[model samples]
Target chain A: MADITQLEAFVTQVRRDIVRQVHKVNSGHPGGSLGCAEFLVALYQHVLQRKEGFNMDGNQEDIFFLSNGHISPVFYSVLARSGYFPVEELNTFRLLNSRLQGHPTTHEGLPGIRIASGSLGQGISVAIGAAAAKKLNNDNHIVYALCGDGELQEGQNWEAIMYGSGNKVDNLIVAVDLNGQQIDGSTDTVLPLGDVKGKFEAFGWDVVTIEQGNDIQAILEGMESAKTKTGQGKPICVLLQTVMGNGVDFMMHTHAWHGKAPNDEQLASALAQNPETLGDY
Target chain B: MKTYIDTGKKDTRSGFGAGLTELGKTNENVVALCADLTGSLKMDAFKANHPERFFQVGIAEANMMGMAAGLTIGGKIPFTGTFANFSTGRVYDQIRQSIAYSGKNVKICASHAGVTLGEDGATHQILEDLGLMKMLPGMTVINTCDYNQTKAATIAIADYDGPVYLRFGRPKVANFTPENGSFTIGKAVELQEGTDVTIIATGHLVWEALEACKTLQEKGISAGVINIHTIKPLDAAAILKSVAITGCVVTAEEHNYLGGLGESVSRILAENHPVPQEFVATQDTFGESGTPDQLMEKYGLNAAAIVKAATKVVARK
Candidate 1:
């Protein structure tokens, strides 16, 4: 386990990266990005067993996919900070000709992205395919993916959820960032996702709930437990309960900042709450 | 004129099955995924022979497409199979985002294309598939002429590393191409030579084009036939060379003239060397239940239509 103080510092740095990257463009999903910062930070910095460099062929190593690709801010930040690319490149978050597209894609030859996402309900099936490939290649590594709770409304996710369990794809884990907020409104208002835990359990997944999805320690512990449940004849689902716009005081508890960037005044205030432990990009 | 004979008849879907069966023994990285139309798609042999490498996605084509895209990350060449409609229209966005945009090396093998799917009618027949597949930037779109050509093309796409849409039909068309012939991605086949008019065709219409050439020959009009298997990276050089000699052209296929091979050919001619071109295809109409022969005749997608188009186009020239 990573020291709580050091991990907490890394989480603070990731939050800073998310806000500044989105604030520079004035167009991005800071809510989910901020919400997913701790889970991604814990996964990349501590949990995943990946190789030194990135390659499309993920043989002999674990791989990750982001189903909710609108949260590219956090993903790109964690990837760059984790040594996939230079931290300075985070400045070109959604600029023209930058490797960072509005959604995560490999078309621009981005180093860490394996599949093009932002089209919801796709990443889980991609993860299952990678997991099946790993089994075929005799590689003993796991495949992980993250999806938003609102994304579950797409019928294709239900199709994939059924396949993952029916095929006995045991070397896989899919986590839902249950922030309960989407573009229109909260998930309940937009389209109620009732009994997600029950839905996944009925689909035959081994379920675990991280009640404190924004807390670094809780996320780390929940994910680690989820990992142990793998390779035992079923796919795992982690219901990570997070706040929409987690770190910023003004941004939290509302769905307004889901895809809206912060203004100059709001940026300074958001940064003040999470002081930069590491220098800014 | 070059004379041709039908050795026998075979459905193009069986050709795909045969080619997949061959890949099973040769390439270890090759994997197959079917969306519960295993019998209709003729994928029984590949599934029987290589059970471990085959994935039965069970009537879920969207999931099959996503899984195929993901399987490519671990160096697996995944071939996804289903009807033409389900393969192209129903799961288009999934293919666009996950496979086409990402540039995954997958083979979207589609069967039962066009009116020749016969008794199933419009819901199963997909006339706009070629247009949909070709519009994507990096996608290679292929519509095979016969069983032998479809088989050869299926085996060839595996060695080539990119996304490909190999479209074929259900009817037992002429088994005329060489059984062991080599298939090239963007090259066109010149079936016969002529100077009055050129007849270009794809899928089940190549045989009709050949027959049209014979009918035009009797009327003292020499008709040339170019079998265009790959429609996206079209054999533009061959089309240009043929049109320069023939001076007029007729494009035919088992698809809608609006977005099918005819439009693609028209674009080529209109840009470089515009000619008096004719389209021997369905005039923006859906197909209905009938036998393959009756449907082809009713839809005006056979030799008689091709000959009429050729004669008229030649007169305009």
Candidate 2:
């Protein structure tokens, strides 16, 4: 596993890339992307056992699925940094005919993405399916799914949660990016996701909460604990409490930055918080 | 009109059950998933035999669809069974992202499609499923008629890669197609050959089309009849050839005319060979509770309706 300093540097670089890439396009969901940066870095660096040059049928390595696909900026940055595709492709986000679609998809033969997931609430089910497949094939590889807390409002997510827990999808781990903010407003003001931990627990899943979703050490610790919970005859859910748009000072604590890219001045100020660890795309 | 010997009508879902059970014996990779509709979808046989492989999702169709998609990742061919309504509309996004967009090798088996679903009414009877499924990219939409063809389609989808939607029905219809006949995806099978008019039909209405052909033949109006089992990636060559000879077309299906087999056939004919066409189908309306025969009559999906449609099309020609 990488050291905390290295992981922090990697995460900072990823955040810069996400903000810069979104700023370049002037279109994308940055709030969740920024909020979940530390968790994303920890996942690629320490949690999942993945290899370079993407393989769709991953047998020996852990598989990951981004259920709430709006956070493609974070996902794209992590995948590129992890060597799934060229980092230069990050500049082509949402461009016409570009493999880096507005949402992550396998249609363009994007290296790391095995499924199109802009449509929320479907990823958990796909992850369950992949995990189930791993078991059937005796691969022993676990499937990890990351979904936004707001995305759980989608009926499909509930269906997936119920099915996974009821059927004993022991090889799956579902993580909720609980930023508590959505496009319209805060989750409480929009539609209160009353007791997400309790909700998942009631659904028969073994639920855990990461107190500091924006802290790399905390995120890593939470994920390691999640790994230990796998293959225990129950699907596990981690409720990650995070602030929307964590890195940028002005963007934090507001839903306005949920999908808005920072202007030139805002971008400059945001980039100032974190130095360029790796070169920007 | 010629009447085939009575071997007793059988529900197409039964064919699906038989085919899935047989497929399990042949392919160890074959697995089944149901959203609390095992009996309704006739997946009981597969569930009984392949207990480990069969998954009862318990009223969660979306999850059932997703798990099916995931099952395909490990080289396992997952067949998800449910009513047409829940299969297409209720879980459209799930299928769109996980299966269709991802290009997963999952088979979505939907039974009790169209008005023939009877007492369940419009909620269960999905007339728009054909249109909904055919519009998706890389989705092979198949609406099989009769017991043999449904069985054959179920067995065949396992060999074909990528996502496929197999639409069957609850009502029993003819079991006439040869048990040993090859099941091709986009090949249009000509049931009866005639030059005056071509009667194209799919699903439960193919039997009505054959009957309509017989009636037309007896009345000295040689009407051709073709069974278009596959709706998407339509057999354009066969359709154009039959249309060129007949010079007129009549399409029939147990679905709404808007995006049904009729519309697909008409679109093909209009583009390739301009011809006058009439459709025997529901006229963009929801179905009500009634017996299967009554619903077929009300929806203009009977043999007499096909005969009338053929006459009108020939008159226009």
Alpha carbon lDDT of each predicted model: 0.93, 0.89
Give the root-mean-square deviation of each candidate in angstroms. 0.8, 1.5
Regions more than 4 Å wrong, model 2: B1-6
Fnat computed for model 2: 0.85
Task: Classify candidate 2 by CAPRI docking class.
Answer: medium
Q: Model 1: per-residue lDDT, tens digit, B225-291? A: 9999999889999999999998999999998998889999999999999999999988988899999
| lDDT tens digits, residue span A2-87, model 1 | 88788789889989999998999999899999999899988888889999999898788889999999999999999998999999
Worst 10 residues of 2 chain B by lDDT: B1-10
Judged by lDDT, which candidate is best? 1
Output the lDDT of residue A11, model 1.
Answer: 83
- What TM-score, over all chains together, does every model reach? 0.99, 0.98
Model 2 score (lDDT): 0.89
* Candidate 1: regions farther than 4 A off: none
* Residue-by-residue lDDT tens digits, candidate 2, A92-187: 998899998889988999998877788888888888888878887888878998999889898888888888888899888899999889999988
